[model samples]
Target: MKQIGNVYLIAAISIVGGGLFGFDISSMSAIISGDSYLCYFQQGPLNADGSCSGPHADVQGGITASMAGGSWLAALISGLLSDRFGRKKAIMIGSVIWVIGCIIVSASQDIAMLIVGRVINGFCVGICSAQVPVYISEIAPPTKRGRLVGAQQWAITWGILIMFYISYGCSYIKGPAAFRIPWALQMIPAILLFFGMMFLPESPRWLAAHDRWEECERVLILVHGKGDPDSPWVAREFREIKEWCEIERQAKAVTYLSLLSPKMINRTHIGLFTQIWSQLTGMNVMMYYITYVFTMAGLTGNTLLVSSSIQYVINVVMTVPALLYVDRIGRRPTLLVGAALMAIWLFANAGILATYGTNPGPGGVDGIPEASVSVTGAPSKAVIACSYLFVASYAPTWGPVSWIYPPELYPNHVRGKAVALATSGNWAFNFALGYFVPPAFVNIRWETYIIFGVFCVAMFFHVFFIFPETAGKPLEEVMEMFEDPNGIPYLGTPAWKTKNYYSATARMEHGEGLEKKMSMEASPERHEVVGAKEQV
Candidate 1:
């Protein structure tokens, strides 16, 4: 039996898929606002400054948002593909699609062509978003899984930081080709992923679920070592996979709608809402539109450029702490703690805006309000500090752990479909956030913070109540824990309202009588142990 000790390296390698995701997202922000690309429009209702105004401007905004919109559509589809195919295969396909999209975008002559390219790129990203964490989690040992999977978030942040730097660099380029270079640069990593993944192994759990026993054993030997397939160590794992696959096969006709069935409803609800709360936390809006937020905060001078760079730095730095503590501190604590801190910072920011966000020059434009908004009340120093704090909080908590949790929670057989469903939900909310933020910022910036703040508060109960603590536990054990809806240990539930964790545990402990009641959910045995040791 071969014992793999440096699981982190394996996990980190898998998370390169996430770095690709970040680079794809951040690379565009610089080019999106560049003048050379926008100047190609000959028919322009020109502003006095020679920029397009009115309808032309609206068209440009849609074109820019379409990249994100394309990604949303891609996110929805990738989830299904990742589940139906293997995670590694889905990743390989995404890389290929990404290269194709980059080619289309770099060569685009018109708005329509660019939109098509962005849509393709978005789909590639969606697949990465759903599959990278799954790959990382499956490859990692349980004790190190959280930290390793969390590295995906770190890689993503690093990608964003690289994008910010690249954007800053390209801003100085004078021609259309200059802007196109940044967009073209995205193909490099996508190409690497395509070539690199061909050498990687399929997830053993994924193989086992598919009923490829011999292949599963080979992967196990390659990854963990030749162990007694029947030893207690491997037995639990083998048993769990067989059981899960059986449950999944029995529910063979289960469509996405069947997720609403009583047998599957709790998992569905958790899957949907977890993604919702993840986005409602305002992470993407903050990332995709940081410049707009800074400008709104009235930090529009050189300060705006500096602040954007600072956010990139903060995001990267925060990932270090998250990677260090995600497994150590536990998943729920990291997220809830980050959520609470995020709420407080947001409130402080909102207050800063309210107190000092007056339109420049004391007030009115004739009879109406003028552009009197200012960020004068809060010191520049304070604003900078708060920005870092917010970024740091999000980096460690919502940023990493959210990606880590879903794959661990779902049974391997349904992981692809379920994660696809969850990530698709994420993209849907992502689209809503992107589409709605302009209006929200225009009419009620402070109110938007309040709404996000409300989501932060709700996350506390959601984490403590519904979400499981997946640190130090194998995927099989975690799924078993969540299989029973009545197994949840949280507030406002019928079980906990009347009692506590001990009482809930007691009830579960004595539920052997009810075990038979769940017989219909049990899987048929199809595995047998051969001569192998328990550990490598």
Candidate 2:
């Protein structure tokens, strides 16, 4: 019970890193569209009515993309840092960086300063995004892993929802201080995470890998037993971990190049493409630009803010179902169902926008349409409804699933690098979307939804034909799935429907197979020694 408590506490604190990630996603959406922001950034002259006077699409995209760009680089390197210094330390370093970034962003005097601040924050996000899930997966039992790791995504949604409301409340304030207050508020989670992590135990897997067997045993007992290292369940789990660490130590030294081995490549591909497909789903388009989207739907001022807040609320509420059921229902099913639902909503949104939506007039600035002149009734409401449905579908499936899938795919030796590469893919594509969406909306209007709709269809096929089921399987057994040629013979079949899918670890737990294999591999003389003992 205490062990489980520790796991939840660690997860709770660690996911605040995810909250900082979410806070940044929508922070600029509200601030960048404001008149004070425009005037202060010097993008162009302000109107007599106090609106941005001209298009500043480039500036907007640059500011948003800069964070992703920094994250891209940071994610690529964070794996090395985490592997060397440990996941907890990497997260603490990131939290400190996050505080630094929040201070800089809150105090920015110009666009350049703002970009630098956002980049620093993005760098922190990169480190946390890659490390948090790895840390959670290491600590959580397989049965609870999905929900626990899923908490990171929940934190992100909460961060987005909270920041969205904060930005909205501050939208009423009259100066740069409006945006500064929200930017400064980002420091709260970072501070909490940094201080909270100081008391948590380091990953037991990492400890075993470093040959700190005593500490590893203690942590496992604390996490898996009642502070009794000799408890049967704890002994079995620790033995397996130690055995795997020994095997890895004897096989080959783990390095970046080791990921290219045939055994690891498939898992690597799964991790990388999952993140890529997630970005292609177009969730961020709505997440980072809900106010802009609501504006296009003919809402303005406080009305737009309230409507956007509803979208985020729906996101937070729907995510709860996923937390409850992802382990029960499994990862692949949720993803396939989500992709199909998101596709339908995307197409419906596109159809509504194409037929009845309005484009921004030539004089509009920063992608906000000038003076609502388009459909105001049923079509507008339909577009809003479809957008909400899209977010609802995403909240449960891709939103949390993407973060949960990658870290579990690799063995401990290269788990850090695999997650780093996958996270970098997430941010790289995230950067592309962030950089392009404002311009895409301005130039293509409703067609943007069509593009995302196509990506959703593609995602459905990918999940059905490619992703293997990992739920309920132990981490070491999951590695064997990738290595076994017949483990995933029916990729298109739901995991529950597949006959070939079975848990080797569960079979071991039942005393069916592992003892024989361990004896054969770990000690050929075990049988002889047992025979001699029996004869005596």
Candidate 3:
């Protein structure tokens, strides 16, 4: 049977894995504030307002974080599986795991069971999150890589928005169905992803890594050349893949330690931190606990839920511009500007809540187990606005760039493992923050925003000085830039310039060293693609 080779269509379907991430975020966030979930789980002490508060902060945090914890563990191994089995198969495996997890969550009768379900669900998320971007990056052309990979983040935002509304509608349900129904519905996408993957081809780069050159070229032609074997763009891209594969074949097989090598260490650090800092940006914190943030701001019930929904809508909308233009806007400017904007909003939120928040005690508005400091009037609106602006800034910049940046940094040999490591960094901090925020809300209250605000500030300088500009450069030249003797590895070019803008034919015509006869129009039958300086 013929598999789907349209890159855009593949990206759209494969990103269901990303949508599962959105589902997980809103599944818990949307309902945690609702009484049905809190009372059914017996989280903390039940209140007259159906809101509970106190002693189970840790338990509540644990339950909320179990999925993250499971993702953390699953992400660690996802790379190995992706490498050994193939990207398509790895995604399918994660989908199966996701369905199982949702089933477990849907049926759970107690807290332990819920935790188990969430952890299982998290395991699926870990695998998908780590692999989805890697898979997309490998299949997509360099010029369009950012846009294709950004679809994963876009899918995630869509998932969050869709699931939040689903949970919000279910909020009126009288019993456990409020949360259970949403958790069960999570299965539908995972099942779709599992079957959808069956009709998609594996990554061309993955094929090359395993020495399947003909199939590799076919995939490249299919996805990049529109089935034209002699397409110039396809020819150039194929040769680059060939040359890079030849280089990677001589290197030691990738292991965790290989990432520490002098050549790879710079990219390893950069990739890992890019992901780590994404979590520290406090975006997920807002994602997981925005209801709490808005509650503290003064809205409750449908009012608060609808307010949070708008933020998710903003998240979905703001991401589109970046998705279309990131390659042209460049990764550095987006991250720099995004960090600056996020910092301003976080600080704004901190100031508003710090000055005006008051303890509302056990009443805690409505639908919550407990309430701490609360805000009302203009200050509450200001705090809510800050949350909206923060998501607006994050959705386009770090949200997509973080996932797009890391996977593109490495060659095929180490991409699976390296991206897995970097992604694991994301899951690790994501897990810690998941567990940390509930208590932070209790102990430090408004001050939590201050910490994230500080983090945003620190990351601005980090990206300014260290992160290399990768926009529009081919993967081969990116590796070459890192290996360039003139600059440090992480800082690929001496300056962030497009070093290889000329295509193979253009360079040949311009006499940039290659013989004119070595044109991209050379016979498609030639299988031995040699080095740039060598004869074809």
Clash count list over all predictions: 15, 0, 6
Task: Give the lDDT ranking, best first.
Answer: 3, 2, 1
Off by over 4 Å in 2: 1-5, 47-50, 364-373, 485-536
- TM-score of model 2 relative to the true fold? 0.90
Rank by TM-score, highest first.
Answer: 3, 2, 1
Local error of candidate 3 at residue 107 (angstroms): 0.6
> Which pairs of residues collide in model 3?
51-368, 51-369, 52-368, 52-369, 52-370, 53-369
Candidate 2 local accuracy as lDDT? 0.79
Candidate 2 lDDT over residue span 23-108, tens digit each: 99878776766666766675666554665643377667788888998899899889999999998899999999999999999999
Q: Candidate 3: global Cα-lDDT?
A: 0.84
Report the number of the highest-TM-score candidate: 3
Name every residue pair that clashes in candidate 2: none
Model 3, 1-536: lDDT tens digits are 68887888999999999999998899888988777887776744556654544227678788888898998888889999999999999999999999999999999989899899999999999999999999999998766788889889999999999999999999999989988999999999999999999998899999999999999998888887777787666776777788778988899878989999988898899899999999999999899888888777778678889998999999999999988889777788888999999999999988887789886654454434234678888888888888898999999999999989998788789999999999889989998998898878877777888999999999999888778777666666567557666655444554334333324443344333223235554554223223221221
CA error at residue 297 for candidate 3, angstroms = 1.5
RMSD of 1: 6.3
